[model samples]
Target: MAKVLMKGNEAIGEAAVLAGCRYYFGYPITPQSELPAYLAKRLPEVDGVFVQAESEVAAINMVYGAGSAGARVMTSSSSPGISLKQEGISYIAGAEVPCLIVNVMRGGPGLGNIAPAQSDYWQSTRGGGHGDYRTIVLAPNSVQEMADMTITGFDLSDRFRNPVLLLSDGVLGQMMEPVNLPEPNDYDINSKKWALGYRGNDKNERNLCSSIFLDNDELEEHNWHLYQKYQVITDLFSKGEYKDFAVEEHLCDDAEIILVGYGIISRILKTVVEKCRKRGIKAGLIRPKVLWPFPTAVFERLAKTASQFLVVEMSCGQMVEDVKLSVDGKKPVFFFGRTGGTVPSDFEILNEVDKLVRPD
Candidate 1:
């Protein structure tokens, strides 16, 4: 495979088309609008379907319809647009439809700015839609991962019969980088026996696609089954890459505190860690690539030896909740961040680290 320079959004769209996703339904939203525009041109060449639905709601329902028919389907939107699609997302989950949802998240609350932000971390990981379901959310920091994970999301969704979310921020979606596209998998969409259109004149064959279970016991049974599936997903899918400098002696081995972050902030935190190392402050980073099914055990192991943890993000300490939960009050977990498009600088993180290491 030859490596080509591509923007993150374009890379995702190209990856899906190459991965044999034949149906794409989406409406325009900032920071990720390039994705639909790219697909509009590319899908027709491949004889694929690209429908700009009347609204995000319609787009997701279109996804539901395509997915039920056993076609590889996808949709993309920003935070607010994703919110509109949540209802349909819940329906997709209920129907066990396999599809990919790309959330190139922007600033939040309501009709937030178009700048890049990680405000949708919780929403993506914790089932942005209603009901007791979880979307397998993958957070990618680079343009390459954005493309690669889009393919991975489709595979996982089909394997488990669920929705998989490819969560990226506006920064990653707009950034340009080199990516080596993967070879197309030899898959036959017609081979799937459970697709809605495949139902025929067989006598034992009354299959109904629905999320509405009227009987309470039946609903409970369905919920338990989904829970078991989630457990399997957790065991099989949790993954991440860690950069531990001098981790043998605790990140400090001879110092006091460490900084933890992921996504773009983790890139800046790496610089802070290097600066701290130069000053003999001993710091390292634990960047969780898979935000959902978070690497909680890794943090727990680190908490046993690390003196303190300084978590950095671009939100109002959203991921901090998970950090605290993982640490289980074993040590001090401090949060430092600026929300609503105000990204903290390496210097700012360094100052926070300094303050934690040598308090007032």
Candidate 2:
């Protein structure tokens, strides 16, 4: 595989096509419009379906329709536009449809700004729409991961019979990076045995795709089944990435404070970790690449030994909530972050850690 310079948005669009996703429906939104535009041109070359939906709501419903028909479907949008699609997203999840959703997040609270920010961490990981549902949200810090994860998300969604979200910020969507493209696989729309498409000779044997369960017991049964599936997913898929530095007897081995962050901010924090080590300050980073099934066990072990935890993010302490839940009051969990497109620098986060480590 050879690396090619590609923007995150373009890479996702191209990767979707290569991943056998033959249908794409989405409306235009800032910082992510390139995705749909790229698909518009490329989808035709592959004889795929590309619909520029009238609205975000319509786009998501189209995805639901395609997904229900057992086609590999996908949709993309930015923050405000994604809000419009949440209703359909919930519907898709309720129907137990496998689909891929890409959220090229921008600064938000309602069209806050068009810069990069990880404010949507809570929305993507937690059920942003309604009901007790979970979307396998994959956060990509680099353009390469953005492309690779878009394909992996579809595979995971189909394997688990659920929706998967590729969460990326505006900076990632717009940035260009080298990516080794994957070889296309042969997929037939009518080949899957589980697909409830228009087939078979007997009418009585036809399968209906729907989320509406009229009977109370039937809906409860469906919900329970979904819960069982989620349990299987969590058991097999929960993972995170950590960058450990060499620590002596009383450093990370018996340290008091641990720094936690993710996404591009986590990359910056890694540099700070090196500087902190040079000055004899003990610090390690727990970067949750998979934010939803949030490596709770990994952090739990860290909490038992660490004296304190500092959460750094680009939101008003959204991910900090998850951090607190994981640590479960075993240690002090402090938050330091900037919201609405204001990102803290490596030094800024280090200063906060220094304050916690050397309290007066």
The lDDT for every candidate, in the order shown, is 0.84, 0.82
- Residue 29 of model 2 has an lDDT of 88
List residue ranges in candidate 1 displaced over 4 A. Answer: 199-206, 238-256
lDDT of 1: 0.84
In model 2, which range of ten residues has the least summed lDDT? 240-249
- Cα lDDT tens digits for candidate 1, 75-181: 99999999999999999998888999999989988998998888888888888889999888877778888888888889889988999988888888898999999
Q: How far does residue 190 in candidate 1 sit from its true spot (Å)? A: 1.9
What does the lDDT read for residue 205 in candidate 1? 76
Measured by lDDT, the strongest candidate is 1
